[model samples]
Target: MTRNLFLANRIREVLLNGKWIANTNFKEQIINVNWEKAVQKIGNINSIAMLTFHINYYLDGLLKAFVNGKLEINDRFSFDLQPITSAEDWNNLVKDFISNAEKFANAVLALDNSRLDEIFIDEKYDTYLRNIEGVIEHSYYHLGQVVLIKKMFDLQ
Candidate 1:
């Protein structure tokens, strides 16, 4: 398989299933969480719902960059999550997150391997490979936070 495909697979594994580094993936972690607990806050920590939005927020931005050849996301407002008022709202967010992740992974897989070395829009930031890999790493980082937040809810 090409390097781009390999990276896409890694992203899929972390977001969906079959993760080698951890037993739980992003989907599994949030699949059974109820709306009440999803919006619960443990001290000043971000709620599960907010973290889900935050994770997908960057994925959406990266996907845009992949399709348009430019990145336009504002880092400061990336975590501005909408309020979750109902189960349907939370479920929809999860659904959108999964859908976007799948689309992002497929988009990456379809790219030419040589493109991975090319600078992503701006020459100052990094290559496409670096940015793509950064998204996966970023997801895993937030996934850890989600897990801990869930554990905290369970304890309480």
Candidate 2:
């Protein structure tokens, strides 16, 4: 497989299914989480719902960049999650996350390997390969947080 395809698969493995490093993926960790517990905070840490939103926030930004040739996300506002007050709200957010992640994986898979080397919309940011890999790393980072928070909630 081409390098871009490899990266796309890695993104899918981390965000959707087919785990490599971590046995549990983001989808597996969050899909069965109770909405009430998802919104609960452990001490001052971010809730599971907040972390979910934060991870998807970057995915959404990158998706826009890929499609529009510009990155228009505000880093400061990326963590500003809407209150997930009900099961329906949390379910909708998770569905959106899954849909966006699938769209991103497909977009990456469609790119030629050489396109990974091209600058991503702006020269200030890294190439598409770097950004794509960064997203995978970023997702794993927060996925750990979600797992730990879920464990904490379970213990409580």
Candidate 3:
């Protein structure tokens, strides 16, 4: 029928769905998140703490761009929020991560189907109806890792 219900909207669903699963993936009780333990490396994979912030960072960046009609890329070339090197910082980052996700969903819902495919016509991304879906894919890919990483770390 319409792109909103079919294509673009499906992408937005991925983004929102990632947020839902991620929130559940990192439970303090389930994972036993110790400040030192979280940072420990079991090879070269990113820590769960890093994945948590990274997922949110991308959500914020993409949603912020959608709201402003522009794509913003930080020099670090990462999707996650600021790194969590400490106990307090991790807590705050996670809170902001959840809040940003809620905001991102609202922005997507506010957009019409045409705008989704309106062809950004801007230097950044230079694509149409993909900003939301792109972010959704990014979110899902990382969220899956978050789940796997959680399992990896807990086995210790």
RMSD of each: 1.0, 0.9, 4.3
Ranking the candidates on TM-score from highest down gives: 2, 1, 3
When sorted by lDDT, best at the front, the candidate numbers are 2, 1, 3
Task: Report lDDT (Cα) of residue 121, candidate 1.
Answer: 91
Model 1 accuracy (lDDT, Cα): 0.88
Q: Which of 2 and 3 is the better model by TM-score?
A: 2
* Model 1 residue 77 lDDT score: 81
Local accuracy by lDDT, each model: 0.88, 0.89, 0.61
User: What's the TM-score of every candidate structure?
Assistant: 0.96, 0.97, 0.71
Candidate 3, position 152, lDDT: 78
Model 2, 49-90: lDDT tens per residue? 898898889988889888889899988988899888899999
Q: How big is the positional error of residue 71 in model 3, measured in Å on the Cα after superposition?
A: 2.1
Q: What is the lDDT of residue 21 in candidate 2?
A: 91
Task: Name every residue pair that clashes in candidate 3.
Answer: 54-80
Q: Write the per-residue lDDT of candidate 1 for residues 15-107, one digit (tens) a residue.
A: 988468777799989888999899998899999999999888988988888888778888898889888899999999999999998998899
Clashes of each: 0, 0, 1
